[model samples]
Target: MTMRYDPHIPDRELVQLADAELPAVRSSEARVHLENCVTCRARQDELERARERFFSARSEEFAAQVPAVDSSAALLRARMAGLASEREVPGFWSGRHRAALAGLAAILVLAAGVAWWMDGYRRYPLKPDANLTPGATLSVSREQLCSAPEADGLRVIPAALAGEVFHSYGIRGPKPRNYEVDYLITPALGGATDVRNLWPQPYSRGAWNARVKDALEDRLRTLVCRGAIDLYTAQREISTDWIAAYRKYFHTGTPLPEHARFFKDRPWE
Candidate 1:
């Protein structure tokens, strides 16, 4: 039997890898780890793609300001360059002048519904028992459970906490082999190792199980780090609904082979 590689590369390291900022030894180790780990490799790919997308979007905006090669183009270029250099911190959903709110609105709209399967990037079907972390309500900030690895929350929520999580979710009599107690945001992504991020995910159920979500978590972390998406957005997407997130990152409605559909026919039972 093949061993499942669950230990993940830290979120900060993944970002550093994407930015090519790692030192020689660390980079060499990370490369070796990525070569042996399919999930990490996929995450690295997404990070690279996200970085490319971010810069490409910025380039497109700059390209649009080229003044159409007119007679007064020199002055226009100077003005455009001046305009480009001014930086402004963007607020959530404000979309800024460079990005519109259409995508944000779409995520909100799609997040309200649950019928999307094998479709575009959308939230996943949330388990009836899924929940946020304990620290989620302490006014501590959402970044504790939302932003990937910025907090070095690499240690998973201990297994001893599973019973408490299951109890809180009202899942009784679920065998250890039948379900997995997992983090909603996931530790690899800076999700708190507390009750709020914990849930009883069924290994005995459908394609949308812990294994599938594990992949999504890493992918989302990579995207978040690369600025492809915001941390708040990724948190909202996963905590409320992960199926949509899975599709968004994996770009497939169908479950990957790692996720077993053992009881696909009776997911809720």
Candidate 2:
């Protein structure tokens, strides 16, 4: 008869290799191997017994080491009193020190207030009465007159004629006339007329003159146009013919003949 080899020998050896934590081997060959492995089966049993003994020893040692907790009111009170005593002694800062601190705080607040006031003064400075005058006349330079764009089509009147016209229009005082001219060149005339039509309306003549005055003041203040030749140097060249035409027809120097006088005091002039 053929003999069947025991496969249990290898399975027993594997259980020993895993320290007795072995999975079941189902094959006949593996069972036969395990059955023949007597040394491996003995090692597996010894490992399992050693593990059980180790766990039982550890459980006893842990039970012995655990401490019992005490709950006495006297101990708790003593601990709280020790903490309170440690905090009771005054350190660097005491009640007298608090007064000094308050004084220092007050000084800081005063300093901040003074600084704020100084900053405000710097931002909004005081001015003299002279600076507040309603109308102040300023000399117009040639460069200013010429700087107006040619496209603006400004009529170039002689300075003398300009003065006369301003006088006729009730812009008598130096201040008012100055203000009037300023108004004319800036927002007034520029806003009202296009390049093609530059004349002021009869009613708005004072306003137009003011605008011109403002323009002249602005140029003078900037120091841009300075001379007589500079006065006529317009970006838009005013033709000599046009100047002559204005001088002849719209002369402010000559009083209009009786039939042409439009208003009672020539208020619009």
Best by TM-score: 1
Model 1 whole-model lDDT (C-alpha atoms): 0.57
Which 10 residues in a row give candidate 2 its minimum summed lDDT? Answer: 125-134
- Residues 1-269, candidate 2, lDDT per residue (tens digit)? 99989534454445444443344553444446547777756755676567557755764576467552122323344445445544654576676775565455445545554565444332221210122211222244444334655332243434554455445443343332122121222211122222222222222332222222223333332332343223223211122222222222232333224323232111122
Q: Report the alpha-carbon TM-score of model 1 versus the true structure.
A: 0.42
RMSD (Cα, Å) for all candidates, in order, is 20.7, 43.6
lDDT, each prediction: 0.57, 0.35
Candidate 1 lDDT score at position 53? 82
- The segments of candidate 2 whose C-alpha lies over 4 angstroms from its true place after superposition are 1-32, 66-269
lDDT of 1 by residue, 43-141 (tens): 877886886687657655765575532224343444444444333324443437434344344344444322223111112223533333432322333
Assess every candidate by TM-score: 0.42, 0.17
